[model samples]
Target chain A: MDEGRRPDDEKGEAEETAELLREYERQIMALPVQEHVERMLTTLSGLALQRLGIGEKEPAACSPQEARLAIDAFRALTEVLAQDEPERGGVYRATLAQMQLAFVSVAGGRAAGKGGAGATPETNGEDDGEAGKNGEGL
Target chain B: MDEGRRPDDEKGEAEETAELLREYERQIMALPVQEHVERMLTTLSGLALQRLGIGEKEPAACSPQEARLAIDAFRALTEVLAQDEPERGGVYRATLAQMQLAFVSVAGGRAAGKGGAGATPETNGEDDGEAGKNGEGL
Candidate 1:
């Protein structure tokens, strides 16, 4: 008998990738216009958090959960775009600009907070607790 | 005396254009990430509607309001990227992709609905009336 490749090998990966892409596109397509924007905002918030190095152990400036959602949305959007048009270079420029603004906002906000006496960088874990509490509402 | 020299003749058009660009940049910077994306989405939706000959008589298959917010977020993101490195050209690419997707979703959704017997085109006037009436809650 002639040796042949496994039946599932060729189709599995391609199918999986296609399914994933389709799912992502559907999610984006399903989003209400407002929700889509909200998703972008969430992504920006996450980028801001990353830039500020603010986490569970740090002074909570913004909600990490919201930020995470934003990042997920952004990723989904990007994946959908890539699947649709890989060759289009300017397609993502707008999204990038939005992300950059988010980063700057977080950076600037932190800088401003530091400038004031009320928002001092915490030395101990005490402020982390407060941050956690505040982050909960975020 | 030189009567030929007008009172406001110092490259007024160029100055105005520059000022407008700066204003656009500033607005983008101030917007939250999500808002930028929404704005872009709205613009895309409008473009799609125009392409489909769906004029203002019908509500877009997608939410124009939501898309507008996303666009704003994207615009802000782009402004920030352009500030850092105008030559990179990545930010522009991303924005274009997003716009394309938004347009495609609206146009495709309309076309797809038209092609399918089960799918019904929602009239612009009936959008609010049918908001929660159907299982579709987006």
Candidate 2:
């Protein structure tokens, strides 16, 4: 009787686990597309903002206001990606990638201006001259 | 005159790039949320199917038919995640994680079963006896 009971319990547990997994799968499959996109975009935005040093403890040398504006711009771009038209999605993706690349390039440029390694003295002088010109214009 | 000309050219290029970026950002921002979700879910489904060896050249040892069915199930799940509600996004993410974990678990279980890593000789014999009993019952 004890031997039979052990096998039955094991079978029951296995069944329960399988059922739980099936239920989980069903719930996941039921979610609407907009929700998933929103989640992914939100996650991406956070990652991008962190990389840009927006809202971080140490202020980036670049204007924090400009960084915030850039983040807002990205959010706007994500909204465009969320559209229903199939033709638009590809365009949006390519544009988004381009935007991200632009932001990254600007960040790299600033890092170079901060006297980082790989920045030649000539480039450093050029950056300083540009900064001086920007100050004068301001 | 040459120095002035070069700076003007550089500024013109910079302005042109910035305008292109702004236009791209505007286009993306105008997209509806539904399209965004569909794209994300489709990407996820494709990745999952590839991982499960559904489309890959290096086929897994599992039954191809079974793998196809599993992929279909995953596709269904992605369709569900494409719904419009924000509140359900968390549920969708959780479900995605669970589905991925289930695939990993099944793969690990098959490997362990093949290796006979945890099954003792006595337990194996008992399992064989149980199978024989089931066969006789059938």
Report the number of the highest-DockQ candidate.
1
TM-score of chain A of 2: 0.36
Model 2, global lDDT = 0.45
| lDDT digits (tens) for residues B14-117 of candidate 2 | 89979998998645533333444445556555544444454457543233222223333333434334332445656565656664555545443443464443
**Span of 10 residues, lowest total lDDT, candidate 2 chain A:** A129-138
lDDT of each: 0.45, 0.45
| RMSD of each predicted structure | 23.0, 24.9
| Alpha-carbon shift of residue B105 in model 1 (angstroms) | 17
Worst ten in a row by lDDT for model 2 chain B: B129-138
- Number of residue pairs clashing in candidate 2, backbone atoms closer than 3 angstroms, sequence gap of 3 or more or interchain: 17
